[model samples]
Target: MERIKAIGIDAGSTAIKVVGINEKGNIVFYKVEPTSFQMKPQLEKIIEELPKDVPIGATGYGGDLISNATITASEIRCHSKGAHLFLKGPGTVIDIGGQDSKVIVIDQEGEVIDFTMNDKCAAGTGRFLETTAWRLKTPVEEMARFAEKADREVQVSSVCAVFAESEVISMVAKGEPMEAVIKGLHRALAKRVASLAQSLNIIPPILLSGGVAQNPVIKSMLEEELKEKIIVPPYPQLMGALGAAIISMESKTKVTNR
Candidate 1:
């Protein structure tokens, strides 16, 4: 058998993100794929592509499905650890994933002291913007570009996924520009996300993570609304997995030292 390094799997609501770390604690490789209800086969397929000899850790909403992992951690803890590992200090963690958005307050030691989550609805998460984008016949990946072209944002009126769709359609009927509508949708979601972040009462440097962090539209809007700078890691979407990997490697050290 070949010797390998630590691995972390984040079975999130919208996607599965995995990261492999070398012995020196640097990320060596990573992968991300959309989640499916038929997750077992999809997970097995991704695992087959990773080194099999390494200790693995798991996190996120679907973490329990990773029954083979050496340990499992909550998405909140994993994201906090991942952000602190890179930031190397105390700060707030704003993770805007697909199904939910959460603000985590972490100490310099990478421990979560307080957190606020918005899982009761999709209005505060990526799913809200995704639904609006689909209604506009715009691809989710292109939303940032579309919003960037607008000179101003129209009032989205409501952030609820269902209501937002109707609002987008009404704007189109009223000859409103697509850019304004898209920007409005982004702002709508940003306002909800900002509320969650404010609830944590934490300050910058705020680290942004999760798949939705890739979108500059929401990021910029959140910055403008909150008047706070947001720091995004290199692999913004893989933070959860990175944290899990860090814990996995540390766990191995504890065992060896013992």
Candidate 2:
């Protein structure tokens, strides 16, 4: 028997993730790259890294722009599908990404009920943290670690990313520790995200998805704000891709069976 392969692509605002799975749903290959506005070139680059015979399924902000995908899916559907695959419960999903953030409510069967998205501003998203990291002379990857070490409270009052950058700079000039500043940043972001979750009457065992879900500091802050346990998948960032792949495989099976 010949092997069957399925590929999933998450073409996000900042990054692109590609994954290949076998008939048994085992990941056989994966690749990630920075996303670019020029979709064709980027798609070509990612496709070059995957198995040639695999059918591609794409989802995310740039999914519609990719011409090579066998199917293009919505980010919301992909994230919800991905979250349900890992969470397997009735609860909410909070996805904080580079340019936007969203809160999705899912039922027991992994279907989305209600959701809210923030794409207008950079205030509570990963871009806010990135700006803070740049101003503090700290790497973005290490910001969460520094926030974890903070013992004192520092407040970032502004919700606007640009104003928050100014606020962080002023705090630094005032001799505030970097950890405290980062902690404050995380707290502000968590507050915004928590507000979104609360809008949907936050339920327990909230699943955190997207790239920012990997930030322990943000997770800790959000947990405190919501007073609930948060679950982070083993590969938080890859959930969307995996979900898309799973959906593609399932649909193919259904078609074949019919």
Candidate 3:
């Protein structure tokens, strides 16, 4: 049983993340699955696999759907707590997920001070990369490699994800190198996210989380665009679920103490 203390679930739009933590707030069990249309049963099945009677903290766009959750938190709160748990201090958090992107400011005590998000469009999200990958007939996993080896970036001028694909097609038609176009896509996405982060009061020790954080080209370009070093956790995509578990543990402990 590993003496599990709490559980966290991030029922994201594109994927679901579940984390089980021991008393020390360290993850002992972790799982992720591509989101299915039948989300409720999927979530319940995962919850059933873990130890019962422990507090469950839920987050993400689908967090509210977890009828069995002990507590549900916002994506902003989950991300802030998750980033603070890893950084162990106040800083800025840039989370780019499949459907949206958010920049949150965390204060010295690991509280959310301010935040901004781009969920109305796909321009600044992981969806943009997915579209680009499909258009180029390149696997999403290989885009970073092409970008890293590129000698130059052929501009992807469209600010909209749909239009950006047209721009990419034009470049490819003109014989632009695949690597150059891929690098350009990364640059465009980084610039878009950087501008979003700069919209708020950015603090130092900036942390990057979410599935997009795994992209090396995106990470490097973000650092260059924002002019700050970016810190990424070992399991960037699992932050939301891990944060939920930690928050639930803390809250339960507080109640027991009182």
Candidate 4:
């Protein structure tokens, strides 16, 4: 069995990400799941699959809920740390999460120097896209590819997710092409997130993380809007968990060296 040195858990608003790493800073095991109302039991089930007795680090909105964690940190700190590990240079980190979207500027050391987030509205989040996809009767997985085939994207006027849904449905009723509508939706989300990063007056390479990074339409639109290259680390969705696990490994090593 591969020896586990530490583990990190990100109990985010919409998903739970768990990552275990060895002493060499390599991921040994990882898992992602929708956030369950019974998070304790769900987490317990995940932990059971991991190697026992490793130090655990936790982050995200529900980090404190992990009673067994040896250390805890905020999502911003952890994500920046994790991105730095991969980026190895100063850059902006734009994470489009399930419930919120954030733009963070990190120095060459990977420390977060400036950051902004929009948690008050679902305007620029995964939920917004999901709701729009449902209205279009399309799977979220296919939205990007479908949008890519459109010759021109229709403009989605509403900024609010609820209003956007209504607008999309109306367009569908009017015989608007689904590809055009989906592309427009992607543009709307990209612009919303772009504003946050632009507020920092920071430049590329923009490192994108979170569940939304998987969407090609959004990623391409964001790059065009920012006029900069975007960097996506491996397992972009697991960045927070990976960061937490890295911290735990460092802490455990410190104790051993002492």
Alpha carbon lDDT of each predicted model: 0.85, 0.80, 0.89, 0.85
lDDT by residue (1-258, candidate 4, tens digit) is 478788899999889999888788788888899999888888778767766677888999889877778789889888988888778898888999989788888999888889889857998888889899988788888889999999998998637988999999999889999889988888989999988788886856788999999987788889999999898878899989998988777674432210
> TM-score per candidate, in order?
0.94, 0.91, 0.95, 0.94
TM-score of 3: 0.95
Identify the superior model by TM-score, candidate 3 or candidate 4: 3
Model 3 per-residue lDDT at 237:
93
- TM-score of candidate 1 against the unseen true structure: 0.94
Per-residue lDDT tens digits of candidate 1, residues 1-258?
Answer: 223488889998899999988877678888888899988888877877877657788998788887678778888888987899777888899999999888999887989889999967889888888888888888999999999999998999654788889978999899999999888888888899998888767867888887789998788888987898988888899999998988887885432210
Name the better of 1 and 2 by lDDT.
Answer: 1
The candidate with the higher lDDT, 1 or 3, is: 3
Candidate 3 per-residue lDDT over residues 157-209, each given as its tens digit: 63899888988989999999989999999988999999999999999899999
Please list the residue runs of candidate 4 whose C-alpha ends up more than 4 Å from where it truly belongs after superposition. Answer: 252-258
Residues 200-244 of candidate 2: C-alpha lDDT, one tens digit per residue:
765667999878998998897888999989999877888778778
Q: What C-alpha lDDT, on a 0 to 100 scale, does residue 94 get in candidate 1?
A: 92
Give the candidates in order of lDDT, highest first.
Answer: 3, 4, 1, 2
RMSD (Å) of each candidate, 1 decimal: 2.9, 3.2, 2.6, 2.6
Candidate 4 TM-score, true structure as reference: 0.94
| Worst lDDT 10-window in candidate 3 | 249-258
Error of 4 at 11 (Å): 1.0
How much is 217 displaced in model 1, in angstroms? 2.0
